[model samples]
Structure formats: C-alpha cells, structure tokens
Target chain A: MATQASLDNPPQVPSQTSSTGRGFPTGLAVLTGFTGVMLLAASYMVFVYAPMERTLGNVQRIFYFHVASAWAGALAFLVALVAGIVFLINGKMQWDRVGKSSVEVGLMLLTITLTSGPIWGQYAWGNPWPAWDPKLTSAAVTWLSYAAYLMLRQGIDDPRRRARFAAIYVIIAFTSVIFTYVGVRFVEQTIHPHVVGPSASTGEGDFGVSARIGQTLGFSLLTFTAVYATLLAHRLRLENLSERIKQVKSAVLARQG
Target chain B: MTDRVEAETAQSTRRTLKPTPLAQATLAIAWKDLRSELRRRELVAAMLVFALLSLLIFSFALEVDARSRAANAAGILWVTLVFAGTLGLGRSLGRERDQGSLEGVLLAPIDRSALYFGKLIGNFLFMIIVAVIIIGPLSVLFGISLFTPLLPLILLLGILGYAGVGTLVASLAAYTRGREILMPILLLPIALSILIPAVRATRAVLEGAAYSDITIWLNLLLATNVVYIVLAYLLFDFIVSE
Candidate 1:
C-alpha cells in the first residue's frame, strides 16, 4: 500500500536547470530575483535617502541592516518552530526538512546580527561589547541554543530518530528566542534601545525614528523578509536533493551486491 | 458451583482494578530510584564533593575577602548548585541508559508522565541533599549564616525548576553520541531563566530584604518552575516514544 501510494504521486523534479542541470524551481528563481532587487533598493534608501542621526552620526546607518537581519533571523526561527511542531504532530519528512533548513538559515542570520550589534555598540556607547546588555545576552543565548540544536542533530545516527528529536528540540529551544524577544522588558537594567516598546532604561540615544528613517527601516524589513524566504526555499531544495542522493546511493549498493 | 462463581467474580474484580494512580505510580518510580541510589551512594557523594571543590576553587580564584565573600555569596551558591546539579543529573540518567533500565521503565504499564515525575522527584531530592550538605560548610567558611528559613524554600523551587527541565534534556542527551557533554550544553541555557531569578531571590532572602521586595523574584521562580514542569510533562512522551 505504501509503495503504491508513493508511486501514485511521483516526486516533481524541476526542469529549469541552472547551468549544472540540477534545476532551481521557477518559484525559487523568481523569489531570488525579487529578493536581490529589493535588497539593492533597500540599501540605496538606507544609505542615500535616510537622514543621518544627530547623535550617533553615519555609523548609525548600520542599524537598518542590523535590525533587519535580526528581524529576519527571528522570523526564520519562528518558521522552524512551526515546522517542528507540525513534524511532531504528523511525523512528516517534509516538515523536518523545512525545520532543518530554517534553523540553518536562521543561525546564519543571527550570527550576522550578533556581529553587527557589537560594531553598533562600539560606535554608540564607546564600548565594543557591553556585558550584561540584556538583548545582546539573550541573543547570544538563543544562538547557542540553536547551535546546540545543530550539534544535537549531528550526534544522532538514525535519520528518523534524528528528525523526531530535532523537531522536539527546536520546539523547546524556541522558548529562548521568545524570551530574548520580550525578556528585556522584564529585566531590570538593559542598555539596549527600546525602539518599538516603551523605553525602560535611562540610556542615551533611545529616540524614535523620524518619517524618512521609518520609511527606510520599513523597506529594509520587507526586503529582508523576502531574502529569508528565498534562502529558505533554496535550502529546502538542497535538503531534498541530498535525501534523494542518499536513497539512490543505497539502491545502487543493493543492486551491485 | 455458586462458591466457584463467587471466587471467580472476586478474581476478575481484582484483575480489573485500575492501574496504579498517577501519584502512586510517580512515587513508586521515584522510590525505586532513591532506593537504588541509596544502595550505590555514588551520585550524591560525587555531587557533594564536586560542589565543595567548586567552593574551594571559587575562594582561591576570587581571592574573596570576608566582606567580598558575603556580598558574592548568592552568586557563588547558585554557580555551585548549577554545576553540581548538572553533574548529578548526567550521572543519574547516564546510569539508567547504560543499565538499560530506562527501557524497562518505559515498558512498564504506567504513563510516561509518571516516569517523568518519578525521575524529576528523584533528581530534585538529590539536588536538595547536595545543597543541604554544602550550605553548612559554606556558612562556616564565609562566616555568614546561610541558613535562613526562606533559603530552603527558594532552593526547593529553584531545584524543582532545574530538575524538571534537566531530566528531560538529560534523557535527550543520553541518546546522543557526546552524551556526557551534551547535557550541560542543552541544560544550562534553559536553566539560566530559572537560575537568574533564583539567585536574585536567594540574595534577597540572605540579605534580609523585606517580604514585598523579594516577592517578585520568588514569583518569577515559581512561574518558571511551573512552565518547565508543564513543558517537560507534555514533551517527554514524544521524546521517549519509539
């Protein structure tokens, strides 16, 4: 019955080959193009159109990309969490693939956020890295948690067990991300600027953005969301191809024996 | 024939009794672990010695003066507990995995949540015992009375939260290749949410803060404990399920 079901719905392999003939799906291709164009437009607006901050000077421009990356990273992890829960509910391999791809992409983007954050800190606060800064600390912890997720995946041998455990783990690990997102409010003394929420700390340069800055920031956020979708779709395809290769390798070995 | 039928009815009634109550099943598993640990005496002894060694190392490393020691005592206490608790959790679960008893426990008729509560209770007891033993030596060394009535209450809540999450993560880590190192890596980040409030509350209690002043920290600790316990209970069956 299982074999018949699988045969009835054959896997759809994309035909629009990118030089190597392992074709990128048309939807992914369109997404890649859209993301690239939007990213260029966002960068142009951020650098040329947005006004300079009176307090922090030109270096504050990094905030647009930095915050955009952080938002994208958070959204990616949120997708992973949803995928993980769905995988747990139905035991679907596709959901596992989505979860794994999103985590990898999210980790990459979060690493960018963590690095850019310190540079912004150095320009704004005279210190490159401030210990006990709540958002930064929480981000570090979230990064470590998902990094451990990847490491956990590496340690398990059986693919099914690995998928199951990873799905469960990502669901739990996402709490750290939630905590990082809102934990700053509950924490007593954070130096991170409260851009969206009410300012809790008495730190300098925690002001609201002007109209032009908001426009640029909004554009950047939208562009990065597209970028995240593009990356996730490509990563999912890579996972599918790898899985197919593994199946083919085993089949060939059986035939040879 | 009537006597035989009555006897048969009694046998069927006995056989049809519900499986052990949740609380009883939980305690039974906990008791089994406790009795086994009592026989071996390895987990608690190792945890105590490690905690004391951590204390000694902290004193030497910090070059803590009497005044400094009093000020930093809460941080010292929690750091010690976190490491020692991690050690004890890893060893306890590692033994179960190695002995193949985890499988036996899983195969038993009780619900997986019962097994979880059992291990949680066992772990919480071991942590409290280690904390109790260390508090005395720490008090003598630091020259501050660490034995406030509020202290144990805080420790209980903190360790309950810790063990609740730690047991689940330890079980997950036990199945991994780097089983020994993975528990702390997986556990410490989650435990921080609990430990932060715990350390703050412990400090407030030790410093004799007003009841109102310490209430928030205590509430945070209680909230985290409840969250972790519920999360572990919900997710553990999925984790251990084949």
Candidate 2:
C-alpha cells in the first residue's frame, strides 16, 4: 500500500538547470551574500557598535553569536523531537522529512557551536572539558546519538519501519539530551557558570552585554531563524524531488515489464 | 510457548465442543508455556554458557590480582550477563520467528499483554538460572560468597529488570531486517539507563552496604523498569502489528 502511494505521487524537483531560489539567480548564493553582509555588520557592531566586557575584554563579544548558534541548535532539536512525535502519529512522510531537516540543521549548528566554543573558551577561560561537565558531553552525545539514528535508518530497507525506528530514537535521544543538560548542574560544580550572569563563578560574565548589544544579539537570533527556515524549505524540496525521481524510475521499470 | 499453544488448541477444541463447561483458558495457557520451557531448556543453557564465558573473558582480560578481583567481581558478573544475555535473547526470539510459531501465538485468543508477560516471565526465569550457574563458578573464581541472601536478592532483581527490557527489545528486533546487529545496537543505549542502576545496586549490596544505602539505586532500577514496561506495553503493539 505504501509502495503504491509512493509510486502514485512522484516527487517534484524543479527542473532548474542551476542551484537557484525558484529559478532566481541564487539559492546558496543569496544565503552567503546575506550572511556576508550580516557578518560585516555584526563585526562592525561587535567591535564598534557594542561595548566590550569590563572583566573579560574583547573575547566576551563572541558570546553574542556562539551562544546564539548553540541556542538555535537546541531549538532545532526540540522541533525535531516534536516533529518526530507528530510523524509517528499520522505516518506523514512529510513530517518525517521536516524532522530530518531540523536535525541536519541542528547538527550543522552544533558543529559550529563546538568549533566556535573552544576558540572562545581558549581566549576567555583556560582549558576545555575540565570535567564530565554534563553540558559539553551531552551536546556531543546528543550529536552521536543522532548520528547513530541515521545509521539505524540506513540499515533498514523498509521506509515506514525506518521512519518509525528513527522516530523512536529521536524521542530517546531527546530524553538523554535533557538528562545530560538538566542533570549536569546538580551533579558537578563546574567553571561554566549560568549564562544569565554575575556570580561567584565567572564573575561579571553576564554583565558585559549592554541593552543595545542584547538587542543586537536578538536580531542575530532572528536572522539565523530566517536562515534556518530558508534552508529547511530547500532541503525538504530536495528530499521530495528525489523521492519523485525514485517513483518515476520505479514506474518506468514496471512499465518496461 | 509450545505448551501454551498446545493448551490453547486444547481449550479451543473444548470450546468448540463443550463451550462454557471448559472455559478455564488463562491458567492452561500459562501452565503450557511454563511446562514447555521447563522441558526444552534451550534458552537457559545458552544464556548460562554465554554468561560463564563472559566471566572467563573478563577474568582473563582484566588481569586484576586476587585482591581486587573480588571487589570488581560484581561489575564483571553483571557486564557479562548483560552482553552475553543478548545472544540468548536474540536466539530465543529468532527461533520462534523462524519456526513460524510466533504467528500461531499471535493468532491465539489471548490479550497481547498476556503474551508479552508470558515471554517476559519465561525470559526472566531463564536469566535467573544463568545467574545461578554464573554465581557458582564466579564464587569459586572470585572467592566471594555469591549464595548469600543479599546477593541472591540483588541477582534476582537485576536479572528480572534486565530480562524484562531484553525480552521486549528482542521481540521488536526479531521483526527488523538486520536482526542480529540491530538488536544489540538498539538495546544497549535504550537499556543503559536501566542497567546502570541495577548494576550499581548489586555492587552496593555486595560491598556489605546496608539496604538503606542502596535504596536509591534500587529505586532507580525499579523506576526504570516501571517506565520501560509501560513504554514496551504501549509500543509492543506497533512492532507486532508491523
């Protein structure tokens, strides 16, 4: 029944010759261009438009986007988690595809977080992965768990079962992620203090950001949210199109009978 | 499982012939399953052999001297059972599946939960037998009194929780394509939360720790089992239907 349904509605990949936004001059091109522009503006604001931290100096500025990207990745995973539940409920393949898109974005964003975080860590504070600081390890484990989720799906031939298993894994992975994140603070006293501010730990770490800088950070989050949506839509279309091609080829093969 | 099926057929025949006079079906089903497993012993023998081999491997691999081996013995025992138990579980489910017997059971008039519970009980008892065999040799090897009251209690709870989760996972993995590899891969992480606390509780009990000292660990084990049983109950239908 599922095979027949898949055959009936072939995926629709746009027949465009080049990578473009619905036949426009650019797809990734526009994204890169906007990112370049935002980067330039952000750099200007970061050094000149926003004030620096009194205690940590220039390094604190990295928090504006580092934390933003991490936060965004976490948000994406949450969406993926919820979407996984929805996909399981109705057997909607589209929901599963969207869930995968969010996961990919989350992975990419987490990679950025991991990369940028250490650099920021090196400059501001010394040492990395001091303890089983559940925060850092959880993120890495969440990433690994999802990678394994993909591997699990890859091993299965049946699409419906694959989606179901994948959904179950996401739920399990999401639970672990929460456990890792939420359980960390109580278990260990680490150098990585709460971000919301001045305390016995990284003193005045939160005090550096002014109102204008906070506003700038908010705008950066908004921009990335837009970028996430744009990329998600593009990825989903690509998935839909590939599915169509598969259907078409299978149909053609059947007709060749 | 075979006995249960036989009993079910007998009861159904009586139903067709005599109706309400022969309506005691549930106990007959349970009795059949228990008697068949008691006779065949295939699952128990495999689990026991696999568990002993794990202990042997661990003893050789660790190179821990006599002094430390006793302390590490509890960990070694649990780890061996958890892993080698996978083999027993996969074989147990895969055999039923291969023989087309699973369908017969599914076709029988019984609650799905009854079938699940029957499998769980059978698997749990098999694990306990393996643990008993393991305890004898492990005691000789580690020079620890594993037959002590507390140790048996710990073993029973640990084996119960482990096999409970293991049976459900095995049933699901039976239907998956790459049954052998996928079973362990899927089972290990999801079962990690449960196994950790069980092993921990056992370690605490073995170290002459008071029950109060290990209460949290045991509670964690109990809580995890309850959660997984509920989840497995809800989700087993999906795997069976598939």
Candidate 3:
C-alpha cells in the first residue's frame, strides 16, 4: 500500500476508502462558500436593480438565472460526457457512478431550465405553448435522451459491462443536441413564427443592461455555478459510498468462500 | 501485483492474434444470415404482409381523399415502411439469438462488427423489397407516382441508415431483458436525427422541392448514416462480446 506521507507527492491517487475522504479541501471549501455568498448578492442586485425590458417586462428578468441554470446543466452534461470517456478508458466502476450521478444532477437542473423556460415563455412571448420553438424542442429531446440513458442502465446487470455500454451510448445521444440546437440557425429564416400571439423569439440578440441589473445577473450566475459545484461534490460522495458498500459486500462474500 | 502483469500480458497476446478483415468478414456473415433467412422465407413473408396491412389500415383511417392522398402519400408510405421494418429487425435478431446461431457466430474468428454490417444489409434488402410491394398497389389506390429517381434515392438512403442503426439496437434489445418493448423506446429517440432528415428528404422529393432545398437534407441524412455506422461498429464489440 502507498504511504500516507508520500501522498503529498506526485500522482498519488488518494484511496476511496480512506477515513478522511478523498476529494476537495478546507481552503477550497471556504473559498467556494465565499464565492457563493458573493453570487447570491449578485442575484439580488439583478432582480431589484436591473431595469425592466421595455417590451417583455419583468418576466424577462428570469433570463439571468434561467441562462445560468441552462448553462450549468449544459456544462455538467459535458463533464458527464468526459466522465463517460474516462469510464470507458479505465473500465472503472467509479467513473460509471460519477457519470450516472452527474447526469442525474444535470437532468435536475435541465428540468428546471425546461420548466422555467416555458414559464418565461408564457409571460414574455405571450404564449407558453409554442411547439416549434427550437430550444423547447431540443431541450425536450435532450431530456428524453438522458431518460433513455437511465433505461439503458436499468437494462444491464453487470456493472462493468453496463458502464462500458452506457458510456458509449450516452456519448452518442449527447451529440445530437448540438445538431438540434444549431439545426435551426441554418434554417432560421423558415422557422414557424410565434403563431399564437406577438413574437418574442426576437430576444436572442436583445441584450442591453442597466449596471445594477448587470451586476445582479452576473452574481446570480456565479451563485448557481457555486451551487452546481457544491451539489456535484455531495453527489460524488454519495456515489462513492454506494460503490464502497458494493465492494465491501462482494469482498465479504469472497472471504466467506 | 503478479496477477495484474500476467493478465495484462495475456490480454496483449490476444490483441496481436490475427482477426479477420472487416469487409470480407462482414460480407461473409451477411451472406450466411441471408442464406438462412432465404431458406426459411418466414421473416420476409411476414414483413411483406405486415407492410400491406399497415398500408390498408392507414388508407381506411385516413379517409384517403385525393388531396389528402397527394399530401400524405409519402408520409404514409414511409411510416408504413418504418412500422413494418421494425418487425423485420426484431424478428431477425430475435430468431438468431433464440436459435443459438448467435453464439456460433461469436465463436468465429471474425470481428463482431462484421455481424452488424451483415445484418444491416439483410435488413436493408428486406425493407427495399417491402417498400416495392407496399408502393405498387398503394400507389394505384392512392394515385401516387412513386416511380421517380429522387424517390428511390431517398428510400435507399433512409432504409440504409435505419437498418444500420436498427441492426445494433435490435442486438442490444435481444440481450436486454425486455426485448419487445425496450426496442422502440430506445431506438426512436436515438434514431430521431436520422428520422427527421429521412422524413424531410422524402417529403421534399415528393413535394417536388428544389434540388437545392433537398440537398442539405440528403447530406445530413448521409452524415447521420455514417455516424451511426461508425458508432454501431464501436458498440458492436461491447454488445456482442459476452
């Protein structure tokens, strides 16, 4: 076994079963919390101080947190995809858990993003139910793909084989979102207009900001990023525990044999 | 420590052993599957009959007016092909797996990807034949001119992509516990990118859209097929390894 003192040296993988736990540090924690406080302040600044849009009104205010949640979810998805690649390369069961947990968390945030988007849609676009909206359609598909990922996992029994297959499968599903998101850009001219009422699709390019609103929006985004990191830390730990339990159970069975 | 190095060495040795070339192995396995299915003729007959029935039902439910016929002919035809094609896919792999030929093929020296391609080709051929049968009388009944060149190209590309993806999805479904229900749930969404382009290109061809209008859809369809083929090959080894 590797020495504890030498762990401070190069390339040492801190064991998962170590009593003190494996990831993150005290200073990092304090800093992340501080940054999170700063972000919360930013959210307040945006909603309270940011000037309302002349057309879309206060409903457009959700764009800051809205975009941030969506951003973090997309970012988490990329991380999960990377985790999947790592799982495939290493064939380690832990990476599979990381992939699964990250996806679950990502799905939660994406659900918020999807829900919040339509609510924002109803207030700002004058119609909450636009079937042809690319974002809505694409997000629905992305959500479904992850749901499909869950089903794929449920279908397999062997941990290693399941990890390997899910790794490959998720990577394939993830890329189509990129295609779908951008597919409209190519055909933007022909897209179905906001048929139910007035058009709010014109907002993609409409970014002008009051100073207070800007700072608040910026802070809200920061807050969520910190929140995303914190949630991920909690999830990874839970996964590590379940994994340890599995290994310990198997080990006991083997020793009994 | 000693066990790890020994296992690694053994795995390395396995890697260096000669494996069959992809094309020759693919053609050989496909030929084998086609020959077996040809001898039985059961899958083809069932799929053809199923395709006809689906068309008939659609005609009745749709209340097939001439205007509706003009607009819906392509969509109905493709939808019929899609539904009928699933039976061919499910039954083809389902039978192979059930009969124990699956293991015999796995035991062969050839790479497992060869099996994927071979099955895909067999499925593609069956779909094309079914399309021909479904089109002839359905076209007469519906007053559709399904005889154009662009239409054939659209059909061929759509079938190739669908069959290619379907072959792998079917294999995975065969191994998964719920072979019947799990297929469409898994296949349709994964197959969506391909399906969208397939529908668009087929519709464009039928609607007499400008070639330029249809070109991008065709290219995207082609890319979808290529990506699925490569991904399916990468996945075939894992899905079939056990």
Candidate 4:
C-alpha cells in the first residue's frame, strides 16, 4: 500500500521555513527532559552517594555506569533483533527504521562500555587491553558484528531489499551479542568482573555490593535505559526527515527533466 | 522441449530413489555442482593452492621453533582454512550469479532452503578436500603431529560450521556491490564462535590433552554448527526471493 501510494503521489518539497520550524514532539521532549534529570541524579549517586570501593577505590565507581551502559547496549541490540523479526513478518518500513536506529544506539552504547571498561581495567589490573581475556574478546566480537550489520545495510540500494537483508543479518548477529554477554561466563577464566548473580570461580575483580552501591547501580541502569529510549526516538525522527528530503530531491529532479 | 523431458526423467528417477523431495532436490543441486566441478576442476584447485600458500606464509612469518609450532599450528591452520574457505564461497556463489544459473535454480520447484543446504554441502566438501590435502604440508612445514584421531572430527565440525555460515552470507553478499571484500567482512566476525572453539580444540588435541578437556570445545563447536545451519536454513528464502 505504501509503495502504491508513493508511486501515485510524487513528493513535494515543504516550505523552507516550515521544514526548519518543526519542533520536537511533546512526548519525546518530555522524555528527553526526564532522562536528562535522571542522568544527573544517577551521576550524583555514582560519585557521592555510593561508598568508595575499598580495594579499587574510585575507579570501581566506573563499574556502575559501565555495567549499566552494557545493559543498555544489550537491550538496544535486543530491540534491533525483535524489530528485525517484526519487519520480516509484517513487511513494514517502520520496523526496519526502528531496527537500524536501535543498532546505531546500541553501537554508541557499546563504544562507551568498551572504552570505559579498559579505563577500569587499567586502574585495577594495570593492563588496559587484555588480548586473550574471554570477556573482552567476546565483547569485541559483538561490536564488530554490529559494525558489519551497518556495512551490510550500506551495500544495498533498494529499500525493500536492504530492509529484508538487514533484518536477516540482525537475526544472525544477535547470536554474537548473546555469546558475548552470556556465553563468556561458561569459559574457564576471565579477569573481568561479574558482579551480578554468581561470579565465576576464577573471575577477577569480584566485589560485594553494599545496599547503597546496589541502589546506585539500579538507578544508573534505569537512567541508561531511558537514555536509550530518548536516543532511539531522536534517531527515528532524523531518519524520517531524511527520507522526506530524499523524496523531495527526486521529485525535483523528475520535474526538471 | 528438452527441459521438460529432462525434468520428467529426473522426477521419475527421484521417485524411484525414494528420498524426500527436499533431500532429492538438495542432492541434485549438490551433485550438479560437484559434477560441474569435476569437469572444470577450478574451485577446489584454487582453494588448495591458496591454503598452501597461506600455510607457507604462516611458517615464514612466525618462524617459531618446533615446540612453539605445536602451539601456533592450530591458529595457523584455522586462519588458512577461514581465508581459503572465503575464497571458495565467493567464487562458488559468484560463479552462479555471473552465469545467471542461480535464477534458473530458483525457477525450479524445490524449497529455497534446499538451495542453501545444497550450496552449503558443496562448499563443505570443497573445504574438507582442501583441509585434508593441506594437513600433510602443515605437519611437515610446522613440524607438528596433526595425525591424532580427533583431528578429523575437529576439522569436520569446524568446516561444517564455516561453510554453513559462509554459503548463506555469500548469497546475501552476492547481490551487493564489492562482494569480494564484503563477504569476509560479514563472515569472519560471526565465524569467530566457530573458529575460537575450533582452534582451542585443535590445540588441545595437538597437546594430547585429556579427552574431557577437548570435549568442551568440541561440544561448543557442535552447538554453534547447529545454530548457524538452522539460521541459514530459515533465512535463505528471503535472500533469494525477488
């Protein structure tokens, strides 16, 4: 139906003033403001509220935001995977847009988690990048897989075909995300901290979570998730605007001819 | 038409053979590839020569003593296998695209996944042939014992997973521009799950580690193999669809 509609009605360029005057939607703007406030509160909890960790000192504070970013990154990737499956089933460009946007958000979050991880590692273990560590290796694999997902998206010219192939790739690439986050626990040894449920026997940097620390980490996770939501909403808006601009350009070229 | 006559004849032959239609179609596609390959002798030869050359480069670059070669050998072998396998996958699918035969194959009445599994089988066979041939030179050049009983099993599992994913990704990449470069970029990251366990299993087997130790990596390899193959099977239809 959308393809038919676009075929029938050639796009028209909006007035320059109207295009530039478009304001943020009320709901998204509110969410963005709320997320901003929560981020500030979470930062306070990380720096001042949570007690300094005994052994690792202030560097352990990075754990709160670092783990939270990792959680948000995984959630973004999960969103991409679900959106992909939905796009394949229903053949909707909306889900494809959501899927690609989520990957961009996920890649951004993963960059933060990965880069901050080494900072903590440098402080604690005196090694910034541990080459053979299973956790690090798997995390890198996850990052590269999504990066490839974007490359796959770029290579296709047809929107329908791009969406279809990208959806398939998203499904395949999520396995790497699963492996990085969950499967690494099965490996024999990792110097990375596993603070959640049951820390592995040979896991380094294991720490006891006091109530205050747990509360901060919880708040940080909530804030980061909200951040993911806000970022995804903004990304979708940007994509829709770009689509309109492309349609307008094509229409102009056709009229000139 | 001759096409109709051949189709009817093949149909009768398949009915007599009594395999499921999917299996019949799969084997026919694979046999078609193998038969052509037998005549041309191109894909496997290129892969084998590339594998050996990479093997040579590994030995020269590492320049390790015999003791360390045993350790480095698994990494070297898997890397060569991955690179050479990519070569074969690109060519095998690229050939079908360039010759415009893939469209004809799609025009057949078989399920699309039959095409995937067929290509996967053909690629898997080519990789196995290359791997088996390269083992002699690998052991001789690296001066390591690759003759363990478990080595073939490891090679089978590793190549099975590699070719399974490779065939699917190759099809996905073929429609895109610059497929030669794009295939490895799309494949190698996903193949790491297969390669990591594979290299570890090969290393464990080389060191004569206890059976229990190597079983873990073997099982991981098997699990990833099942995952990739099933994913490829379910997803291949959308890839080949118009």
Best by DockQ: 4
RMSD (Å) of each candidate, 1 decimal: 6.0, 6.5, 7.6, 4.8
Candidate 2: interface RMSD equals 2.9
Local accuracy of candidate 4 as per-residue lDDT tens digits, A124-188? 88898887788788888889999999999899999999999999999988875565446545854
Docking class of 3: acceptable
Runs of candidate 2 exceeding 4 Å displacement = A1-70, A108-141, A176-231, A250-257, B1-40, B63-71, B136-161, B203-213
Q: Please give the TM-score that candidate 4 achieves against the real structure.
A: 0.90
- In candidate 2, position B27 carries an lDDT of 45
Error of 3 at A54 (Å): 1.2
For B29-120, candidate 2 gives per-residue lDDT tens digits of: 44555576779876667777778887787767776675665458777888877886787778656777897777766655555565566667
* Best-to-worst ranking by TM-score: 4, 1, 3, 2
Model 4 ranges with Cα > 4 A deviation: A1-21, A246-257, B1-20
Residues A1-257, candidate 2, lDDT per residue (tens digit)? Answer: 65566557644543423333244336555775776677677667767777767777888777777776887788888988988889878988777787888888888888877877777767656764444454666666777766666666677788888777677667766764664465443433455646653344542234545788887777667656655666666677677666666665766555544
Off by over 4 Å in 3: A1-43, A188-217, B1-20, B60-71, B137-143
Model 1, B1-242: lDDT tens per residue? 11211223434444455545778778887888888899999989999999999988877677657655555788899999999999888976688778866766665555778878988999999999999989987887677799788888898998998888889888889889988878888888877777777887888887788897577788877877787788788898887888
TM-score (chain B only), all candidates: 0.90, 0.83, 0.88, 0.91
lDDT of 3 by residue, B1-242 (tens): 11211223334444465666778777776676677778989888998998888888877888767655655787788778888888888876788788866766666556678778878988999899998888797787677787878888888888998898888878777776777777777676666666667777777777788998788888887877888888788777877775
- Pairs that collide in candidate 1 are none
DockQ of prediction 1? 0.49
Model 1 global lDDT (CA atoms, 0 to 1)? 0.81
